[model samples]
Target: MSGTGGRTLLTVRGLAKRFGGLVAVDDVDFDLDDGEILGIIGPNGAGKTTTFNLIAGALRADAGSIRLRDAEIAGLPAHKVAARGILRTFQHNRPFKGMNVLENLLVGAHRRVRARPWAAALGLPSARREDAALAAAARETLAFVGLGDHAASDVSKLSFGQGRLLECARALMGEPAIILFDEPAAGLTSVEAERLGGVIRGIAARGIAVLLIEHDMRFLLPLAHRVVVLDRGAKIADGTPAAISREPAVIEAYLGRHAGAAA
Candidate 1:
């Protein structure tokens, strides 16, 4: 499933959100295809996070539409959005402090292990089987993100880079169709950032669409199939990564403004 060749899996059009008189997102539109890695970049206060919130249902849109596989989901709650196979990782990784890495991932897989209340309460065979399957999946995901050795370690004890990997593992436990990554490389050393980039590519190779909001241009430009640039609250450019780099409006509004760093 090539990024541009695949069928459209998500469509956002005229998406707008406002806080008082300040428009955070204004009439933005974009499409994400199956197996695509779409990057969203903009200067500070460009409404990148607000766009994510609207799509994830953490914030309701004041205007516009969001469709997931033809189903309207713009106004749904966060949990409802997750039920539709969309998951996200925050810029700040927030693993359960009291839980081990494996246990934290188990919480992510809870949605898939559908044991009846009675079955769980009675500690029936079905519940036991479900628990085992979830544990296996969690372990597999931990290994995939290169955190297998830390599966039994306390989450609070993990380094910042390890915590980010752990967050990705938890997201994978859900087996989501699309994962939204908000600055996955923030605060990482160069080596750690390189490792995170590989993990992201591995995820896309598995045919999951990725929508990344990141400020690291070096990391994002080479990885994304397409790049969308936002200035203020509106989309200024959307095209192939190469095309986005050469776009004059993008250069003038964003890239040129942050010439030496992320745009």
Candidate 2:
């Protein structure tokens, strides 16, 4: 198996979803190659978020299969899915306001999916060791995402761009093989977005796959290795950025989809 049949790190086959009489997502199939930066785009209400929700286990799929590195993961709980090396960020870069930035990141490092709660609560020696390891990893992850200076800062204190970086840092703390990013560059300034683009390339350099759902084609174009276009829950195009931008079907899909969305 090669080309479409081989080297895929993630796969969605026969993917579908339903809400009463509405089909939010309908039988979509796609593959994300290993370490690839896959950019996904669609107009408003095109089921892009629905697809992310389904793959991230935020919602149950009516029918289909989601595979990470060839392992089936459909119907699994969100945390369990994350344990299988899949981490996801939402369109809104919501950070826990109760915890400082570092503390919030440390929480994400507990990726084993099983730990002695009481031990952790009481700060047992084993738990202390785990905390230390996570704290160090969190620092490294923060620096990797260009938030090292803000490590001791509060989450409620971050700028929009900084918050997005923190979200990526938190996801990296889990040591995920792949991360699903939803509108990561949304609400960012031009300079901030460019910095984030550089950071994403660094992430790919670290050998983690990134599958992003973005509406800003101008920003996504330079970063994405491949682009996938969705229309009314179905994939309308899949190819390089140049090819995708030239596809008439894709242009039509975005015409009435999102007025302010850049192309």
Candidate 3:
């Protein structure tokens, strides 16, 4: 279903993946709309990360169709998929160790750089102008993710939660049509998770599609416009947060019997 007034931006059908004899993902299908936050939730080994990897081109799908609008992106390499405007953040922060926060963010904008290597090597006017512009945009993204003050700080100086926000800002610098988040709230404290939730909402408000795979139900349910539940690598429920909370199968499989009351 479309979110608010947004149109469909991503479509997945019969998506399947296997690791030897184990089925990691089994014929999953879903649609993501522009400006929507779609959460994929499941217990351990339920194919959440595998599905995420397939969509982001981090892993090849053994069978299925993954389309960004009308173009097939299922088998594309990671860089090619990123070039097509899909960016992602990992469960663990992976910032550039030697770079300052802003410099790290600038790396994410590499796809948008227009100057030729020769021009940049020679420090030509065009290259200088492009560098300045990208740097400015990177700063804006840093501020947007609440890391404005850390722009000049060493990446190692930031706390774990701050590092996660940095990962988010770096992805935003790519100006992605869709952003895949793998367990974003995994290592965050309650307050940190809440803050991150607000940042995610802000991202969706800008018309970027958000596909999140999170194990934290409390964080996922309230923030997602729609939730897709998986059990044993198969989708068992798909609906609004409220509806998902009350699903018998979902409750039994993952959410537990108290899910309705908790939600």
Candidate 4:
């Protein structure tokens, strides 16, 4: 279900990306509202990932405007975009190799740290206080994602599902205005995916926008407030899950003959 009475948080207009002669994202435009779950779905080579990369600032858009609260963020570097309150998770888990779960989460909060380098290096009281506060927040975030018990566990010791949850917790450490999830349900058992879906719903309930790209309709359709369907690098449909399910273009281009069964 869509969040009601929320303001628009992110806007993309005329967004386009090209690789040599291939148009990866063709003049795409979409709006993400605060506390909303917006899903992007398409078949392979449909430019979903490319669109995600552009929004996350991992890739520059060839032509378009990306606005975060009215500020143009189209060509900002990934770190800058992150600092501006846009964070993302990968399709695969990317835990910090040597860090424990809590420590890995702390790393995600680096952009939020306000202490000067010298202050931290000298162990000044302000830096120490900030460190303590951030650590506390990290713990809170881990608990939010159902990973509280694993705070001290080595990242390598985590199961695949736990690692994915860790990634979500880490992203939360940044206090993002929007979190971009790339194929979040991939490689998870049904139970794990169901749990992750609940966590995502909680995230939106807290007023953070969620942008999701996933191939798993069973996992995404019921979770998203709205969905954008892409075909051949262009959006073919954009609406509520039920509405999208009935879109003729979407069915023909991406869902195929068994669209009804899939829906």
Model 1 steric clash pairs: none
State the lDDT of candidate 1 residue by residue for 168-189, as single tens digits: 8988888898999988998999
lDDT of 4 by residue, 127-154 (tens): 9999999999998999999999999999
Model 2, span 134-187: residue lDDT tens: 778788888888998988888899898988888888788778888999888888
Tell me how far the alpha carbon of residue 105 in candidate 3 is from the true structure, in angstroms, after superposition: 1.2
- Candidates 3 and 4: which is better by TM-score? 3
Off by over 4 Å in 4: 1-3, 257-263
TM for candidate 4 is: 0.95
Error of 3 at 250 (Å): 0.4
The segments of candidate 2 whose C-alpha lies over 4 angstroms from its true place after superposition are 1-6, 112-127, 255-263
Model 4 CA lDDT for position 234: 89
Task: Put down candidate 3 lDDT per residue, 100-150, tens digits, no spaces.
Answer: 999888876887798999999999999999999999899899999999999
- Candidate 2, residue 43: Cα displacement in angstroms equals 1.0
Once all C-alphas are superposed, what RMSD does model 2 give against the true structure? 2.9
- What TM-score fits each model? 0.95, 0.88, 0.95, 0.95
lDDT of each: 0.90, 0.83, 0.90, 0.90
Q: Give stretches of model 3 more than 4 Å off.
A: 257-263
User: Looking at model 4, which ten-residue stretch has the lowest summed lDDT?
Assistant: 254-263
